[model samples]
Target: IEGGLLASPPPHQYEFARLNLTYVITSKRKLAQLVYDHKVNGWDDPRIPTIVGLRRRGYTPEALQLFAERIGVTKSDSWIDYSTLEGCLREDLELKAHRGMAVLNPVKLVMTNWDEVMGVGHLEPCSQPALPHAPHGASSDAAPEGTEPPPARHFTIGKEVWIDREDFEEVPPKGYKRLFPGNKVRLKGGYVIECTGCTKDANGLITEVLATVVPDTKSGTPGSETVKVKAAITWVGVANGVNAEVRLYDRLFLDAQPDAGGKDFIESLNPNSLKVITAKVEPSLANALPGQNFQFERHGYFVADRVDHVQGRNPVFNLAVGLKDSWGK
Candidate 1:
C-alpha cells in the first residue's frame, strides 16, 4: 500500500489511475459483513462515525475549521499520534460548550436531610452560561451589533440526584475517594456530602445510598466554601432531567496497526467497541436538535446524532471522545 501511494508518474497515467483506484483495497466487505451479521447497525452507524459523520453528529463548524488550520496541509503521511488529534478537539471544545451535569451510569443518592432543608419543589437550577467568553463582533455599530444572546441554562438543584454507579465501593480501593462508608466527597458544581450508608438489593446490588448534604456548602452560594477532597463526583437532577440514548464508541480495531499484518482486517475489530445506554441529561439538552455538541460534565464530549435526533422524539447522542486526561498514550 505504501509503495502504491508513493508510486508517482507511472509508465501510463491511465494505468496508474486505474491501479491507484482499483488495486487499493478497502474493508468495505468486512464492514458489510458486520452489518449483515447484525453486529453493527449500518454504514452510518453512530459507533463507526467517520469525519463527515462526526460533522453530521453535531461537531461545531468552528471546531472543524480550527482543526483544519491546526493540521495544516502537510503532504507527508507520517504516523500522527492520536493525542495530537484529541488535543485539537479538546482545544476546540474547551470554549464552545455550556457546563451541565449528567449521570451516565446512575446510582441513587439520597440525602438523609432531604426533607429538612431542601423541601419538595425546592429545585434550584444549576448551569454555567457565562462560558469562556461572551459573543461579540459586528459589521457596523448600528447593525444591532451583536444580537441578543441566548438564554442562560439552568439545572434543577435538590437533595437527590443520580450519580455514577462506579463512584462507590463496599470497601475503599487504594486511591478511591468517591463513596465509602464514613467517607466524604464533594459533589462537583453542587455541595459537599458525607456517605452515611447504602442499601443493597436482594442480589447485593446497591439500590440506594444515604448521605447528608452539608448546609454550608451549596456551590456558589454565600456560605458555599471549598474543602480539600481527593475526588469530586458529578450528578443530575432527577425531576428536571431529560432521558437520552447515549452511544459510547471506541476505536474500531483493538490492534492499532491492524492493516500492518497481511491478514483479514476483520479479525482486528474490537468486540466491545460500542455500548448504548439510556442516560439522564440536563434539561437544557433535551430540546437540542441534531448536531448539537455537549460536554456531559464528567462523562465526555458528545453530540446529538444527526440521523436519529428528533426534537420531540427520543434524543440520540454519540460520544465524540473521553476526557482530555486519557490522551498522549
Candidate 2:
C-alpha cells in the first residue's frame, strides 16, 4: 500500500492472515456448525487453521517461516505433499529443543541386585546434557569449553525404573538388541543391566521385568567400559519421575487432498488423530513452561500445553512432530 493523495494498495494485494501452505481452508459459512455441532472444541482447536490454533498446536514461527520458503507462493494451484510441512518442524526443533526422556507405554523393570550392589533404597544420580549435540555440519561454537561439563538435566535411578514396553520382548524377534531374558543393555547414562526374566499376570500379560545390574559399569566412570552392550535404552526413575498427560496428535485428514475433486472432506477425517495417555517423564520436565519445546529423547518433539499445562501441578503436553517422517511407513 502507498500513502499518497489517496492511500492505495499495491497491485495484487490481499489480506494474508496466516501463511497458507497447501492445507484445506475451511469456508466462513461452516464456521458456526463447527462450533455449534461440537465438531471441534473451539475455533482455536489444533486441527483448525486459525492463528490461535497454530500457536496452541506448538507450530513455531521459525517452522512456519521455513514452510513458506519451502513451498513458495504461486498463482497456479498445486497439490503439495503434507509431509513437506512436517519435515520443516523437525529440522527447526532438532537444534533448539531441550532433551528429555518420557515413557508413553511404560513397563516396570526391577533391578534385582540393587541392594547387593548399591544401597537398599539408594537412588543413584544420573545426568545428561540438555542440548546434547547439534546437527551435522552446523556451527560448533555452541559447544561448551574443554573439561567444562555442558548444561545437564539432573535425575536419579534406583531399584525400579520405567521403560517403554516396545523396548522389551519375551520372544526374541530375529535380531532385537533390546531387553530379553539373558540379554544385556545399558540403562542410558546410568548402568549396564542384564535381564534375567519377567513375571506375568494370570491373564498372560507381562507385569514386571527382572534385571540385574552390572557393578562398577556406570557410564562416564572408570571401569564403565568393562561391559559392552549393543543397545542403550532411555529410562526414568520411579523415585524421581513425574506423571504427565501427553496428547499424541496426528493428521486430521487421511487423504492428502481431502477437499479436492469434489470429494466430501468430512469423510476423510482421521478417526485416530488424537490419543491421550498418561506418561512418565524425567524430573527435569516437571518445570517445562507453556510454549516450550523439547525432544522427548526416543519419542519426538513436544510442547507444553498452552491452556492446560500447569507448572509443578497438572502437567500436560502435545505432540508437535515426530523425530522422522513416518508417512505411510
* TM-score of candidate 2 on Cα atoms, chains taken together: 0.89
Worst ten in a row by lDDT for model 2:
15-24
lDDT of 2 by residue, 270-293 (tens): 787789999999988889898889
Report the number of the highest-lDDT candidate: 2
Clashes of 1: 2
Worst 10 residues of 1 by lDDT: 15-24
TM-score of each: 0.77, 0.89
**What's the CA error at residue 54 for candidate 2, in Å?**
1.6
- Model 1 residue runs over 4 Å out of place are 1-40, 46-51, 57-77, 130-150, 226-231, 325-329
